[model samples]
Target: MLTYTPPIAEQRFVLQNIVKVDELSGHNVFADVTSDLVDAILEGAGQFAAGEFAPLNRVGDEVGSKWSPEGVTTPPGFKEAYGAYVEGGWGTLTGPTEYGGQGLPLSLSSVVMEDLGSANMAFSLIMMLSPAAVEALKHHGTEEQRRTWMPKLVTGEWNGTMNLTEPQAGSDVGALKTRAVPQGDGTYRIKGQKIFITFGEHDLTDNIVHLVLARTPDAPEGTRGISLFLVPKFRLNDDGTPGEFNDVRCVSIEHKMGIHASPTCVMSYGDRDDCVGWLVGEEQGGMRAMFTMMNNARLNVGLQGVSIAERATQAATRYARERVQSAKAGSASRESVRIIEHADVRRMLLRMKALTQAARALAYYAAGLTDRGQLGDADAQARVDLLTPLVKAYGTDVGVEVTSLGVQVHGGMGYIEETGAAQHYRDARISPIYEGTNGIQAADLVGRKLGLEGGAVLASLLSDMRAGAAGEAPLMALIEDCEAVAGHLATSSTDDRMAAAYPFLTLLSVAVCGWLMALQLRAAEREDGDSRFLAMKKAAARFYLDQVVPETRGLRAAAMAPAESLFGLDEEAFSA
Candidate 1:
């Protein structure tokens, strides 16, 4: 049935030890955040996730969300689960204090999100998109706009969605044809169709605030002409309550391979030619405002990878321990033993555990850095810009790989729908493709991020890796490889850089992950308490360094491969 144990202990280890989240308490922003508070938050969230969300995962996937002209109906029990989530104040974790929120660190909220996503990945999307909208409005919206919308959105009474994709404009935001004409009053008449909008239409919240991108009548062509608008499903009254229908219609929802409970809607704005929206920023500043929301989502999407992988790993491990299969290779007993006793099964389980922990560390580190950056650390912000793509691309990639391994661990039973292993893999497949496809993330890594601060960002990261490596030969070698390939791509042509993007991203991500894991190992080793959890940390870190991190060597080679090899025979050569 795919039970999840919350992994609170592991999350604590990463938060307190690896990321040194406790250190953030010294800052005025996180002054009230004591270690005890962190522990209590983790414990409370863990219980809520296990008790409320875990049991509904199978049902959510099996029944999915039902759609009609009225609106989208979430699977049974989903509405109640969402109610509990809202009433419990779960969505207000990292929100601003002025808008009736707790104003906690992004790092803390990230762990809570990991727990929620682990319990129910499909259902968690309802909570994930709201805070991002709050962030967008907080950063780019006017004072009146923030006062009007931020409170309910922060409180989870309303949900938010980023409406950017059209039938023709997928990744290319410049190609969207959505129009927003100024209405002489404060609002604009918005007319467009947006596809693949997650949580676009759902029954969980009363109002859905859509941050949409459209172009003005006299706007220039392409992305420069695009502008962001705050459009709601129902127009607000003078008292800030949902009043009238705003012509925001859900034409239909998509039937997909995974996250069936998350409604990916084909949304039509101004079907009646009366939909009203307010400009978020300037007339042609949509891309800037949208990126604020997207960057937040990209990190959470990376955490989604870690969350699903953790769930899948636990499921696979539990099955391995209970399902009796074959005798051990060197055992004398003829009777069948648990599959976990088999060396190969042990190998797969270890790999899953190692990769899951590594990805979690990477994502958490990025989140923690975000908190630091928010506190006005310029260097931390620069480092964060570099790590965002790595966390997004590599973290989601690990989710897909680890979930696939979970299926392989279950063997024939994994293929059966009843076992629930298949769902994890299916759900994970979308993470790499959405929130900016992993390929685009990789391209961003090599093309843009690699050149941050005129190459100083990469250099700073390498210096940290060197310090973390602490003369460990394998880790040091991988760091050198990352540096070499990064240098090669710097001087390479556009085609060459694009060709090497994916591999370089993988290489650099592994190097950074290796450094983080090494830090965890050192922390574990230094602890005086001889606990089994600490022992597990040491082992996972060792395995990651010994086994997984070494893949960087080959990736470095691929990163350095000439673009000529890719272009030698381009058009129709394969068919010939």
Candidate 2:
């Protein structure tokens, strides 16, 4: 079986030294996190992910999740592994201490997530859902709601799901048709069919808190009228244990391209007309509340991209080191040499490592900004607003590319299921599509985020990226292209903006990741560290700068092209 060895050293190096969780230690939310505690936590999370979760990745993919009249049954060992996970308080890393959580910085939680994703992407998802719900509830839940559900959800005794997508509504959440009828006692009877609900109907927990988006009878039209509701699978008893079954039912789950172990269900609310939901924030305020969870969820999905890349890289590099192939170019003997000795194989391995490492650093940096933003840093909030989309779109794009390279490295064996390279590729396919498609993310960067503070955020961000590129000529050249593209995006017409957003976002993402990778190298040079690892870090930065950074030129040109051709395509012409 293929295995995952957590990059504990690299994680600690980034968190403790580079991103420096200590910067946020001054905040009350992060006050309890000491260096010793943080180290222990990282080590523990790594152990859990590798020893417990990694062993389950293949099993989960093969067995997948099973559904029946009794609900969903997870692949074997998932429930037990999750049980151990919660018992060890792994779920509490980012939860609030008031609700029995550790309250460490999100950057720390981000590192833990990397480990978990590397181990078992499907299983890590169940853990991810609760946290998004926790964030929404933590920010929007009423006192009674918090007191009742926060502890259970945070501790992983229960799970949660986001219910927004329907048959007709996908990204255009404003088109949703779910309805809510006020029951006069501050409760609402919710009736809707929500699709792509992960962990929606599963035996992992008796009570699954689903945050649903619905429309009230008297509410206005469009997204402005949608309201958020907290609907539990099992009705709560007077004493807090699950009482009767709520009207939430799993109609079916998706037979997807990847992450099969994760049950993506089509959920029906009020199937029996008895489904009761309490308002989460206020009526006609669902989109606002959902975005709160989504911005962070977008980040989580981006990290999934990073996780898959790490797993694929590890598998491919291992195979390269062991798989004996052609002898070195100048070798005299007829003896076969390991693939790692071949130049092209080494290039592929280094490229995979470079992109994965850059993506990881960029993700960790964005997560650090998340904590800073939460701590009332206005600049950090602006940074988060801008970086979130790029992280999701670019990170996942790199993930797909890197995983494909992993398959390339494995040669014939990669095509076979037993090598496990294909699984990472299959699992990564969903990251760019979910939590807002990469296209939407790019448009968000170009249209919404670029307009922040009358375009000062994008301008200032580019300025800093240029400054960071100080001595690196390739990065400097890329920064210039990115800055020019930003200028075009800032002034482009709506049609042009829509056409160029994707390439613009890709160029900017590459520049930013290159910048972060540069930062990692400088930090490595300054700090007293492991020589071999530090050398590897410098080498990765070099590869990213030299081999991968040139794509920005082409991306910039495509981004600057006219939108007319795209708009001119006829429906039938487009189909061809």
Give candidate 2's error at residue 147 in angstroms: 1.2
Per lDDT, the best of the predicted structures is 1
| Cα error, candidate 1, residue 138 (Å) | 0.8
Please write out the lDDT profile of model 2 over residues 46-123, one tens digit for every residue: 898999999999999999998897789999998899899889888888888888777777898888888999999988
Which residue pairs collide in model 1, if any? Answer: 228-286
Highest TM-score: which candidate?
1
Model 2, residue 499: what's the lDDT? 96
Ten contiguous residues minimizing lDDT sum, candidate 1: 527-536
Location of the lowest summed lDDT over 10 successive residues in candidate 2? 14-23
- lDDT of residue 550 for candidate 1: 80
Look at candidate 1 and tell me the lDDT of residue 421.
95
lDDT of 1 at 469: 98
- Clash pairs (backbone) in predicted model 2: none
